[model samples]
Target: MKFEIGEIVRFRKKHPCGDDRWEILRTGMDFKVKCLGCERVIMLSRPKFEKSVKEKVEVKE
Candidate 1:
């Protein structure tokens, strides 16, 4: 469940915008994530965020 800021992540559930992908903005007790489809920002608790995460997308250098 290790992740970093600026990493792209997928959730088990799709967003209202119909995208399941998100970009990690901030990490800690709460995670700040941005929706890739709608460009909306949201904050989710660590436990909630971790449970919903499907996978982390590899970022290219």
Candidate 2:
């Protein structure tokens, strides 16, 4: 699973806002993700993100 910055992914779990969509802000050991539904930002580790992500919608160049 290859991920890049600015990509959108749908996580297996829904956020409190009831949305599973997230936009990738940063990638590496840690990732900066912004929730599409609530416009909230969260920092998550790579392993955690990988485990949470159910599908990658878009890949940034």
Candidate 3:
């Protein structure tokens, strides 16, 4: 559940744009994520985001 800025992650669900990859833009009570394929930004609650994220592409640093 711990991730850093500039990290990439894949979500458990596919976006409407048909992509699963996302980059972490910011993290806090809410997370800011951008779709890797379409570069769309979305803000989600921490728990919701944690559930949506399938894997982290970059290790926490």
Candidate 4:
């Protein structure tokens, strides 16, 4: 899936904070995302990111 900055995404697994959703902060060779639950920022390699993501969340404006 194509990921754009500011878009929300859902992962296959939930975060430690108990949320499965994350907001995309940056994208490229590596991805920077913030946990929706804990508001923690994390960076993940493209490979790991693609494997972890279940879908790109479509948020209503």
For each candidate in the order shown, give its overall lDDT on alpha carbons: 0.93, 0.94, 0.90, 0.92
Clashing pairs in 4: none
Per-residue alpha-carbon lDDT of candidate 1 for residues 1-61, written as tens digits (9 for 90 to 100): 7878999999999999999999999999999999999999999999999999998886624
Candidates in order, TM-scores: namely 0.92, 0.93, 0.90, 0.91
Clashes of 4: 0
Local accuracy of candidate 2 as per-residue lDDT tens digits, 1-61: 9888889999999999999999999989999999999999999998999999999887776
Count the clashes in each prediction: 0, 0, 0, 0
* Model 1 global lDDT (CA atoms, 0 to 1): 0.93
Native-to-model Cα distance after best TM-score fit, residue 41 in candidate 1, in Å: 0.3
Write candidate 4's Cα lDDT for 1-61 as tens digits.
6788898999999998899999999999999999999999999999999999998886535
Q: Once superposed on the true structure, which residue ranges of model 2 sit more than 4 Å away at CA?
A: none
Cα deviation at 61, candidate 1, in Å, is 6.0
Q: Rank the candidates by lDDT, best first.
A: 2, 1, 4, 3
